[model samples]
Target: MSFRLYWPLIVLLLVIPVIILVWQWRRRGRNVVMPFDHGQEGTGFWLRLLLNSAASLPALVLAVVILILSGPTRLKEPEVKRKLTNIEFCVDVSGSMTATMGEGDRYDASMQAIDEFLEARQGDAFGLTFFGNSVMHWVPITTDASAIRQSPPFMRPGRLPSQSFGGTEIGRALLACRKRLIDTESGDRMILLVSDGMSADLGGGRDIEVANKLKGDNIIVYAIHISTGEVPDAIINITSLTGGEAFAAGDVEGLKSIFASIDGMQQAEMERTAADAVDYYQPFAIVGLSLVGLSLVCSLGLRYTPW
Candidate 1:
């Protein structure tokens, strides 16, 4: 509720109206010769005061006009809004992903979990990338979750075109996903890596190299190993270096729980923007209009006559 004048120097013009009002109030009555002097009675004290006030209305109106011209503005309150996050799902489509986890296989459970995750995060942008020996961007980053939701059946491990797509190359897949996330100019970036096997391509410190690249761009990596075995050290290194963690999901329930945990860990952030100044001329305009009306009414009867 704070107010300021954009052109504060223009307020000096108010002195013009102030001087006129003061001179009108201080001057003595003039001695004019009348045709007949029945009684030498002057105007009553209250009536004289009323006349002075009526004359001052024009000066008051002038002051209001000057204030309006000075460009008065008020500070608007700050607003809190949720920060957007861009999530890219990097799912493994190797032949091993077809193995049973719960009632369905690992690939089915992973897609189902991903769908649930999309449901929870309504306003965020999402992308889908499937990787084996090859990398394919199934869906580009978008706020619409329907595209990612409809992607699972087409990219299932067993349904891939050739046996060449059966090998897991975690390092290559991560780099590909990183390239996609880097093109986004705004919001926080993240990659969710879902796989059941270790990558032969990530050995010989290649994991560290990829992790450093992802970290430099402020991209987080969350890995989910959907099997009974321990998660690979290379996967762990990448996730840890990029400010994320690796989870091992033994069954469908465990996988879903892991996704829930990730959701809770990375809750939507709230940010408050600085207050801005907006035009505050309504009050001054209303006052000026009211004074103009009053001045018109006073001119009809409350003015002094020339004798």
Candidate 2:
């Protein structure tokens, strides 16, 4: 560690010794010599040294006080800290997700992949949202991943053609997810959109509007579509507008690979941030104060007789 002074002008203290010498020389020149003696004239060298030290204690204390006023400090290196990214899983629970995409229905396969993703990314904050005709936030954005991992079992595919829970309203769902992320107001924001059907709600320029909103909030959307047909243009546009991409996964393995790809992408986003420096002047201040107090105590009884 390196030490520095805020008020380096305190270096003027180096002239104090010369000033004392000059003052003593002038005083001796003006004084008339008189033969004087004390019994201590035969004092030993050690006693004479002790007397000199006692007389010089005030100067030592003054030097320490000047050093303290200079604001002596030790410098610390800047540190890098890792920041958590906030990821909200926006899953479709409409009846269409019950359609078979692999060994199990699309909903079940997606949930499994999501669970694996959560396990792999333990350091990030995660939120869960299940959307059919309406959007439900199963878990708020939190660093605790267990809430998101345990959420899939409670959410099931709803019957289709119903206004309550069967239709795909991607627009509204996107908005809902965006609101949750905005409320968090921290970290790198992301939305993992898992769906297997085309949405009627994204028909009339709604996707563009929602994408702009997500972009405005610095939210990136990564869509994973588990479908036999091509992924919808709306999904692509929404993801691309926010600097994210849409993935088409036909099988369970493909789904896993997609999640892994996303995990890789997020890892690249982790960056080093500079941290504040720590102050290390307290101990020096304490020592300086203690020296001043000791000098006061020494002056009470320690002195030398002039001979």
Candidate 3:
């Protein structure tokens, strides 16, 4: 906790005079000694005591008000993950992501999301891969987003059936990233594979085997399946089994919202304040006003005149 106004604390010095006055009041004599006297104390002494006690209430309350007015604030720090995220962004260049449902085709939308994802991340290292007939690595794992963006495209690998929308080799692509991401000394490591094809096998030999291996080591595998609709069982299972989420982006709009939620890559949120900080002073001020009013009423009822 910190204070914006350190000077307000000086107001408490006024209490020193009150403290001495209180002592003097406690020792002072009272008025009007009574005739009926088994245990009789003078009125002046008790009046002095009452005044002294009442005086302390307003003083303390004022002191508290001053402190509150000083603008106290507290900063809470977060525990930084011991090992930064070793993230692999594997995308399908398998050719089907090229199929269009909106202004931007599925592949274009995925790449746009990837660009946003890369821009948002803070302290983590990231890498890129594109899988068509075979796995192609765009950038070996690195923290530099600009470097990855400037690098050459993961050139479409040629094999049999070049015209058949590039054979989906998601399994091999994931496997290629496995050793590099897993063997890294980074603490929290993961893979994010994005594709539009249900035709692709996420559970193929390389994927299933590597997924199982990585899970055992606490490495997570996430998949974002983009299409005109729901993702297939193969894509869902790979993400589920490897302890990650599988989300289907219906179109560009839904994809945007999903990517907004997918901002773990973004800079740290330590400075952001809670959305619900209300000014509590209104209630306190009301209570203080009530106390002061009550004090006036009590004085009037007692008729301030000493008998």
Candidate 4:
């Protein structure tokens, strides 16, 4: 709780004394409350008492007014939203990924397919990586829904990161994905490797090292095999190595359905929500008012009574 206004400029005005009557200061009581004198007191005696109490009335009212003017407040927190999965789109940015297989080339169609998948999820964070000769992070593990919705169109042959001069380094792509996709502790963590079956060099025996590291993490790798050409043995082993599933993207419909299943992990209906709570400060003003009111009532009624 807090006070909205600490400075009481208007409070000073409350001290202006109310002139009840020209004779108010001069009033003197003739009656004495002796044991035998009570019966002789007149009605005017009670009237004097009421009139005297009136001196403190304005101050009491002023105090309540000040309290109302000062604002007091308190705070509230919001509930957490639904979270489902941490997904990574391991796009084959290799030179072959630009080969035209469907209406657009593999890369363009793959990006569009990823966009569709992202649309269905409410509670998922996704990352993008393009691997050809080297792996590049287009985006990192993020819940940036808008950015995910709008991926840059698949690169034209000339625009891609690097040329695919080397053999398919399938193991390298998987290694890169293994590193990115495993850290999101809860829900489902996965890597969807989309590529024309080609393996880039998975540097030496690091495949077993990475597989051993990811053994206990609930990470799954899904293979998106583009049926546009002959797939290599290394591309096929990605899902096998990680104990996950594989899908063939021979047609646009299959491509759509395959990615849809990946995105469905982010359903998160029970875990989705947005809320904001704020605090206010009004009680301090009231406390100040009560204090000032009590002081006035005591000062007025006790000293000025005329019974």
Candidate 5:
């Protein structure tokens, strides 16, 4: 811990000792003041030391009072306030995801994994987006997790397969997710894309463009492909461009494991920052007050007297 003062000019009070010495000499009409020798034997060594300490009480009190007036403070070490990671869950709600791959359909199983992912990364901020032929924001990027918890039921598979939420359009979905992450002011950004099929929207190097956009913004993409056959090369390129990975989750258990892997990756990117210091002055003020009290008590019986 370190000490500091707000009003350092108050320490000028140390000049009190010089002023008192000068006044005492002037009042006695002496150029060189000498200690009064009573001619009797001096008191014992311990007694003389005790008497000298009593005479010094006023000076000690003055110094303490100066410190009190200066508003002294004790500073504590810097603290790490937050280690934040902003993650956007980009899940595919295409009709293909309705295929049963585990205890439930791929979509349902992925939703459950997403819920567990949120729980595992407790302190990080999260967003939720669902994509197919079109993209939709299920939850904005935020520290609150309640919105993510309620998303599975609202956007579950087999609701109503339409062009807006029924076909896998990876490029368009990634672009939309990137836009959302761009609007975020701070923190490490990530996109967790879950899809079970390839997309026409990824043709004509559109996928490459999306990947570069994500990489430029420092947005990592982690894709979980839940289909039976080999995962798409386009998906792998999109994820790896931004220092992320693509995984093929054949069943519910594989999907859960992929989510756990993403959790670890996000945590690995977490960073800590210094927090503001709290003001601490009460103890120093108390000590100064105690010195004043001691000075008053000493004055009652230990002060010098002209005999």
Candidate 6:
């Protein structure tokens, strides 16, 4: 609530009103030569003081006006807002994803976990990409969760087209997701990869290449393997390189827990915006208006007269 002036030097003009008010208070009374024989009495002390005060009202109003013209300002309160994060879900729709895990298959568990994740993260932008032998962008990066919520049934592994989409290409899917994430010009970028098996394409140094590219573009990769087997080394490498972790979830509950862990690890950031400067003329304006009203009232009787 501190006050500041845009043009501080203009405050020097206050000297004019100060001098006028001081002179009005300090000047002595003059004698009036009346035609009629009246007593040689002077104005009473309280009456003289009241007259000086009434005369000083205009000077006080002028001072307030000067202050308003100086452009007074105060800092507005700071605001807290959630920092946006763009998350792309790269889910494998290969044939192996149809294998059973808990009550449903790996694909079902993954989709359910994703639904829960979307519910937990209400303010983030999400994109959905189904990857097998090829990649399909089912949903674009957006704040709307309805599209992502209604997407699982359509991209189920069993419902995907013939054997053309049977192979798992983790590196290719990651690269595709990275392309979509990089196009987004704002927010923290992340890729959540869900798969049940290893990809032949990610072996040797292809995983490193993809990881470096994602890292260069500031995209983090969090991998979730919904299988009893260990998570692939390539997946671990990519996630680790991009400042993320890989988790293996054997059942539906573990898959949900894994998504929750990812949520905990990549929590939404809180940002505090700098306070803005706003005009602070209300007090001065009120004072000026009051003085104006007082001056108008005093004009009827308390003003100085030549008589």
User: Can you list the residue pairs that collide in candidate 5?
Assistant: none
- For each candidate, what TM-score against the reference? 0.76, 0.68, 0.54, 0.57, 0.79, 0.77
lDDT by residue (tens digit), candidate 4, 1-307: 4445664544453343333333454566565554564476346656566655654555455555654555444445556666567888877666666677578887677878888777776567888877767677778888886765565554344476454522356567667777776666666677778877545353465555555555556667777887755544444454556676677777777788887765554345445345443434345455656656666676654554445
**lDDT by residue for model 3 over 1-307, one digit each (tens)?**
5556565454464465466556644664334566775876555647655665554455555654665675645555444443467888887776566677468577667777777777767567888877765666778887778766654333432322465438776666777778678678744677887877754555445456656776777767787778757877766666778778788887887876676665543223333333432344555577667767655665654323455
Positional deviation of 280 in candidate 5, in angstroms?
Answer: 4.6
Q: What's the count of clashing pairs in each model shown? A: 0, 0, 7, 20, 0, 0
User: How far out, in Å, is residue 266 in model 1?
Assistant: 2.6
Model 1 residue 203 lDDT score? 92
lDDT for each candidate structure: 0.90, 0.80, 0.65, 0.63, 0.78, 0.89
Residue clash pairs of candidate 6? none
TM-score (C-alpha, index-matched) for candidate 3: 0.54
In the range 122-209, model 5's lDDT, one tens digit per residue, is: 8888999998887889899999989988878888767856857777788988888899999888778899988999877877787788
- Mind giving the per-residue lDDT tens digits that candidate 6 earns over 130-150? 988889999999999899889
Model 1 regions lying over 4 Å from their true place: 1-39, 43-48, 55-71, 101-104, 285-307
On residues 1-307, what C-alpha lDDT tens digit does candidate 2 reach at each position?
2335533456676357446544533443222234576533343558545655666656665666666555556546565555778999999998888888677899989999999998888878899999988898999998897887777668778543457668888888999999999987668999999998898888788899999999999999999988878999999999999989999999999999999999988772445556444556677678767767776777777654444
Rank by lDDT (best first): 1, 6, 2, 5, 3, 4
Give model 6's TM-score versus the native structure.
0.77
Candidate 5 wrongly placed segments (more than 4 Å): 1-9, 12-59, 80-82, 270-272, 280-300, 304-307
lDDT of 3: 0.65
Cα RMSD to the true fold for all candidates: 4.2, 6.8, 10.6, 8.5, 4.8, 4.3
lDDT of 5 at 208: 87
Question: Which prediction has more favorable TM-score, 1 or 5?
Answer: 5
Ranking by TM-score: 5, 6, 1, 2, 4, 3
Badly placed stretches (over 4 Å) of model 3 are 1-83, 151-165, 199-210, 264-307
